[model samples]
Target: MALPLLIDTDPGIDDAIAIWLALAAPELSVRGLTAVHGNGLAGACAENAIRILEAAGRSDVPVHLGAGQPLARKFSRQGWGVHGSDGLGGIGLPPAGRGVDGADAVAFLAETLVQAAPGSIALAPIGPLTNIARLLREHPEARQGIREMVVMGGAARENGGNATPHAEYNFWLDPEAADIVCQSGVPMTLVTIETARSVAATPARIARLAAAGTRVAGHVAALLGAYVHDGRSDALFDPLVIAYLIRPDLFVRIPAQCRVATGEDSRLGALLWREASEGAPHALLQAPDPDVIFDLLAQRLRQLP
Candidate 1:
C-alpha cells in the first residue's frame, strides 16, 4: 500500500521541489499540503503551494492555508529575500488555476488524521511548526493517527544556521511552536540543516539537471539557477525528506533528545542535540550519500510532469 503522507510547508524554493518530489513519487499518497508562515508571508505561501501543485499538474491534491505567523512571535519581513520576491525564485512558473481547498489547516489535518486508520499517516513538515503545533494543541487525539514526522528544520550541531548564528530559519521563525511539537510526543525524525547542507547545488549539477530534458527537470534547473547564483551554498534542503522516505538505505538514523531554544533573541530556535535514552524519542538523520540524493531527485523528476 502507498504510504499516506501529509506535507506541511512554507513553499520555499526547496519546499516547492520537495512537494513536487512527493507528488511524483508513486509510493506516497499525499493527502494534502498545509501552508504556513516561512520563506514568505502565509498568504503568499498558500499561493505558492497552489502554484507548486499546478506546476506538477496535481491540482487534485488539496492545498490548505494554515497559520500566518508563529504561535508566540509576530511575523516580520523575513523569507522574502531567501526565496526571492516571489517564493519560486522569481522564476514565474505560472500562477495556480484554483484557490485553496481550505483555510483551517489545523482542523483539516486533525480531521484527516481522525478519519484515517490509526498510525497510518506520515507528516513531513518542511517549514515552520506553527500549523503542526496548533493541530497538536487543539486536537491531541490526532497523534494516534500519525505514524511519524520527518521534519526539515533545526541546525543539529555545528555549521550554524541560516537565520542567525544560533538558529535555523524555520525554527528561528517560531521556536515556541517547534518546542511544542518536540514535546508533543510524536515519533520524530529530524533531518537537520547541518545534515542537509551536504547536498549542495553545484553549478555542474545544475547544468546536468538542465540537460535532463524533461519538463520537470527544466523548471527545476531554472529554479535552482535563480536561487543558487552569486556563490550561494545552494542547498535544496527540503527534498531530502521525501528521498529519505523513499530510500531509507541512503540515510542513518541516530537517536537524540531534541530541545529547541525558545529565546526571544539571537538564540531563539537553536536546536540542541544529545544522547537518546528512554526519555529521548526523536531520531536524528544522517545522509550517507548526499550526492546520490540529487540522482534520486533527477530520477523522480523524470517521473513527474
Candidate 2:
C-alpha cells in the first residue's frame, strides 16, 4: 500500500514540481496539502497548491490554508523576483478557487494523523515550518501519530544559504517556528540547499518531458522556463524532498546535528549542525544527486493526467 502523507508547503515553482512528484508517484498517498506563507502569501500559496493539483487533475487531494506570518516576525512577502507573484512562476493556469469539503488544512492535518494507524502518516513540509509547528504545538500527542516528517529547508556544512549568506529561506522565514519543530523530536529529515542545489534542472532534461504533450509536462516546462535566473538553469528544490520518498537511493546521507536560529537579522534562519555533537537534534545531508532525481521527476511528471 502507498504511504499516507501530508504536504505542508509554500507553493514556490519548485514547490509546484514537488507537488507533481508526490501526486504522480504512486508511492505516496497525499492526505492533504497545507499552505503556509513563504514563497508567496498564504492565500496565493493555498491557491497555487490547489491549482497545481487541479492542473494534474488530482483535485481530490485537499488543500489547507495555513498561517499568514511566522510566530515572532511580522509577515512579509518573498519578493516576486524569487517565485513570481502567483508562485507558479507566471505560468498561466486556470483559476484554482477553493478545495473540496473539509479543505481546512489545519483540521485536515489533525484529523488525518489522528485517524491514521500509528506510524503510518508522514508530513512533508517544503515551504516553511509554520503549519507543521502549529500541528505539533496543538497536537503534541500527535507526534507519535506521524511516522516521519521529511522537510526541505536548512543549509549545512559547505552549503551556504539561498535567501541569505548563512540561512536558508524556510528556516529564515521563521526561526522560532523551525526551532519548535526541531525540538519536537518527531522523526525528521531535512533536505537543504547543500543537497538540493546539486539537483539541477537542465534545459535538455526539461525539454524532453515538455515535448511529451502531457498536461503536467507542459506545466513543468513552463515553470522551468520561467525559473531561469541570470542565465543559469533552474533548480528543483522541493522535488529533492519528494525524490527521497520515491527514490531514496539518489541521496547520500550522513547523520548530523542540526538547529535553526531564531535570532534577529543576520542570524535568523541560520541552520547550524555538527557531524560530531553530543545531542544535536536534526540530521544533515551533505550532497544529493540532481541527475538521478530529475530523471525520476521527469518520468513521474510525464505520468500525470
The Cα error of candidate 1 at residue 134, in Å, is 0.6
lDDT of 2 by residue, 57-152 (tens): 888887878888898888765554676656677778888866534556666788788887888888899988988888889877677678878889
lDDT of each: 0.85, 0.78
lDDT of 1 by residue, 1-305 (tens): 88999999988889988988898888898999999988888888989999988887888989899998888888866646767778788787897788888558999999999998999999999999999999999999899899889999898765488888778888888999999999988989988888888888887888777766788788899888877784444886899899888887888888888889986656778997787765467988888665588787887788876
TM-score of each: 0.96, 0.93
Best candidate according to TM-score: 1
Lowest summed lDDT window (length 10), candidate 1? 227-236
Judged by whole-model lDDT over C-alpha atoms, candidate 1 comes out at: 0.85
Residue 180 displacement in candidate 1 (angstroms):
0.5
Candidate 2 scores a C-alpha RMSD against the true structure in Å of: 2.2
